[model samples]
Target: MGIAVNNINKKFGQFTALNNVSLDFPTGELTALLGPSGCGKTTLLRIIAGLEGQDSGQVLLDGEDASSRHVRERQVGFVFQHYALFKHMTVFENIAFGLRVKPRASRPSESVIREKVTELLELVQLDWLADRFPPQLSGGQRQRIALARALAVEPRVLLLDEPFGALDAKVRKELRRWLRRLHDELHVTSIFVTHDQEEALEVADQIVLMNKGNVEQTGSPQEVYEHPTSPFVYGFLGNVNLFHGRVHQGVLDTGGMRLDVPGHAEAEDVAGIGYVRPHDLDIERYAKGAEGIVVQLIRAHAIGPLAQLELARDDNAELIEAVISAERFKQLDLKEGETLVVRPRRLHVFVDQPSHHNQDAR
Candidate 1:
């Protein structure tokens, strides 16, 4: 079943945590609520789970209102950052806790409960650790146990709040891939909240980007990355270089360099800003009649497959960065203090006025 949040609003005293936020989580697909801290992602998640009440609006689970339901009745499973496993319980016992706690009339028989726990342990590939206590398991192993426990109850929807946050980087990466595979196999409707962009991009089928209690954009990883709808979206998604200038006709003049803006329909002469990602920047040795901005190289470092370069505009001393392939860097043989012409292979322009119109890459 799908979940729909309609016109949800929440406030904590004078501060508005969520302002008229609405979103749809498709059935059997993973959705990620991605944002910085204090952006209301967690608040919205809690509200959907019936752990927090909304000031206004309703949460619908499969087209039925679930806003007033108790957390247990909602049939939603939650996994937090910490494993929250009982130190005294073995892995098998921890996984069986949910089933055992059910009312006697609804509880499964002891033999059935044991079988279910065994199946869940095999599903998580930790059947060997069934007898080990949480204190004896590694951080990653503990998280796997936690997820197995969450699934033991057969939740209608699974919600995870940074479930892998406490693990080490290597473990986090490994678990992300594992989780993606697990989600595909289980086909459970799941939503997870995280501030890590890479995790969202790699693990989720849909991403809802939130900021300041508002949704900036919602799309697949590639859609949002290739076509950002706002300056905030562009800046938040990846490394971007910003240029402040004024637009005349279709040209942006930054006092030091002019960028040719083609197919821009805005007729009003106004200040505008331009954004170009590091990989979109092209660098060449300076020469006459070159159609690009002239910049002086401050430094360059070859990191694995890419070379990161710091450059400054000759006319205004504006700083920008460019990342190029190591092979290209070697071909150019660039050095510190060398003059180079920089051009954007693709650019995004936005009008800096009362109404900002974001121009997609062209």
Candidate 2:
């Protein structure tokens, strides 16, 4: 079932942790709560699991109020970053712990518990490690066991708090793919908190990007990356080149150069900012009649398939970076300290108005 958080607010003493946050996690879909540390992603996850109470508003599980429900009654499966496995118990026992500890009336019989534990172990691909102690298992294996334990209770919703955070980079990547496949097979409504942009982009069907106490934007990976709604969203999602200047008569003058910005007549007589991604910039040899910004190349590094160039504006020495394919770099044959013309294939401009309350706000 889907989960809905409506107008939720939370605070710690004088500090506001979450401010008027509202979100929807679609039924049987994996959603990622993504943000930097202290952005309330973890706090929101805890609140949904009934582990923490909100100062205001409600959490609805399939349209039923779940705010007052106890953690166990909520039927939420939670996995933490650390492998909270029992050092004294075997893998099979760890997965059976949840079922065995249930109230007598609801607890499964001993034979049933063993069967269920066996199934979960097979599902997590760790049946071979059933008799191994946690200390004998690898980091990835322990995490998989932890997830199997969470699923043993047949939770309605799964909440993972940086579940792969303790693993190495390669292991983390592999586990994310595994988790995605597991979700597909089970179709459980799951929400995981991650500070990693790549993880959220790769693993989630929907993404909620939060900063401070507010959600900056919510969309699929492609939607958010292609069309960022705010400056913070653009900056946080990827690299961006910024141009600050004054706009007049559809032209922006940065004191060093002027850019012709058509269809921006309303921005006349106001300060404006322009943003362009490194890949959107086109570089070429400077010609006398060339119509583009002139910049001097500082250095060029060809690493793997992409070549990165460090450039500086000729007039004010403001630095910029451009990334292109190695094939294009070889064709251009760029040299250090040489003047080059740069044209932005696409640009996003916004009035230079910063919001005091929401820094990412337009």
Candidate 3:
């Protein structure tokens, strides 16, 4: 079912947790409410699930107001970060809890509940562990059981809040794909909340980025990642080298380090800030008289696929990070406090003076 939240505002006394926010999620698609902690993603999700009421707005399910509905009546299956499985219940019992909780008139027969629980267990690839309790299961397995429990109700909408955040890095990555596949199989409209930018980009069909209780951008993952609508969105979504300067002849003079930015004619002589992605940065051999100096190497980590370098950029004394293959890092022989030439071909500039319309345009 599609969900439409109109001008939802929530507050806890003087703390306005959610401002005048409005969003519409279409049916059967994975929508992500993405933001850092305290950005109100969880509050919004709870409001949609009827766990908490909005001060001023309507929660509409398929164009019908559902604000007055209770959490149990909303038919929203919630998968929390902690899994939240009952320790004493076996996987089967946990998955069957919801069905058994309903009144006699609404509860299914014993055979029906068993069949449904078994089917869901198979769907989550956990039928083999059906007899095990939550403590006997691994973290990932427990989460799978929690998911199976949520699906037992066959909820119209699934709301997942950091469903895999508590797992190990490798397992979390695997479960992200698994969750996407499950979403495809179920075709249930799901809204997932996450603070991890890569997770949101990899999993969700559409993304809504919020900041300070306001909707900053809503688009496809690539659209929002590639073309961030504001400085906050650009900085928050990924590592970016930000330098405040002015544009001259369509090229930004970043404190004498020149960057060619096309289609920014009006920014000449106007103060602006430039952002360049870490992957877009090029290492200049020390002798080429490169634009940037490695003022500080904060840390270098071997994160499987790439060796990430955290360094201080000379221009504006801002910290910058770069990710390169092991082979590349070895060829460069980069060490702590070694000056390297870093150049960027593309540019993302923001007009500083304007309150709005600060975007990352190529």
Candidates in order, TM-scores: namely 0.96, 0.92, 0.91
- Order of models, best lDDT first: 1, 2, 3
Per lDDT, the best of the predicted structures is 1
Question: How big is the RMSD of model 1?
Answer: 1.5
- lDDT tens per residue, model 2, 233-346: 888877888878787766767665577776465564778777778998889999997877789999999989999998998777458888999999999888899999887777
Highest-TM-score candidate: 1
lDDT of 2: 0.88
Which RMSD does model 2 reach against the true structure?
Answer: 3.1
List runs of model 2 lying over 4 Å from the truth: 249-251, 255-263, 316-318, 353-362
How far does residue 195 in candidate 2 sit from its true spot (Å)? 1.2
* Model 1 misplaced regions, further than 4 Å: 315-318, 354-356
RMSD for each of the candidates:
1.5, 3.1, 2.5
Worst 10 residues of 2 by lDDT: 353-362
Clashes of 2: 0
lDDT of candidate model 1 versus the reference: 0.91
